[model samples]
Target: MTDGGAMLPWLVIRQDDNGNRYRVGSYATQDEAQRIADSLGGRGPERLYWVERMGQAAPS
Candidate 1:
């Protein structure tokens, strides 16, 4: 997480086959984030994309 993305709470995330997650970008609405994620979807069988609300950190 970083500064500036605080206002836009929606996150577009990409996870590779190795299970490493990366933040693509942030949006003001979930729909907007999901649209970007969906556009990037299915590019590769091993790559996965989705949207999540920012500020909540997952257990490591």
Candidate 2:
């Protein structure tokens, strides 16, 4: 858990066609979130998708 008392294991970042980025959801593990992101391939040039850790500012 993080300082906020919430689980900070994994996070999914997704971008919409309108150039808006946001957190899609959280996962118990990084691998779990990575699998979901991989399955959502080719979001398009206007869209972005990636997985990251809760406290991380960028995907590693």
Model 2 lDDT-worst window of ten? 1-10
RMSD of each: 3.2, 4.0
Assess each prediction's global lDDT (C-alpha) against the native.
0.84, 0.76
In model 1, the Cα lDDT at residue 58 comes to 40
Off by over 4 Å in 1: 1-6, 57-60
Candidate 2 whole-model C-alpha lDDT, 0 to 1: 0.76
- Write down the lDDT that model 1 would get: 0.84
Best by TM-score: 1
Error of 2 at 22 (Å): 1.5
Off by over 4 Å in 2: 1-8, 43-45
Tens digit per residue, CA lDDT, model 2, 1-60: 453676658888888788677887788888888888887757666667799886778733
Clashing pairs in 1: none
lDDT over C-alpha atoms for residue 30 of model 2:
86
Cα deviation in Å at residue 38, candidate 1? 0.5
Error of 1 at 40 (Å): 0.5
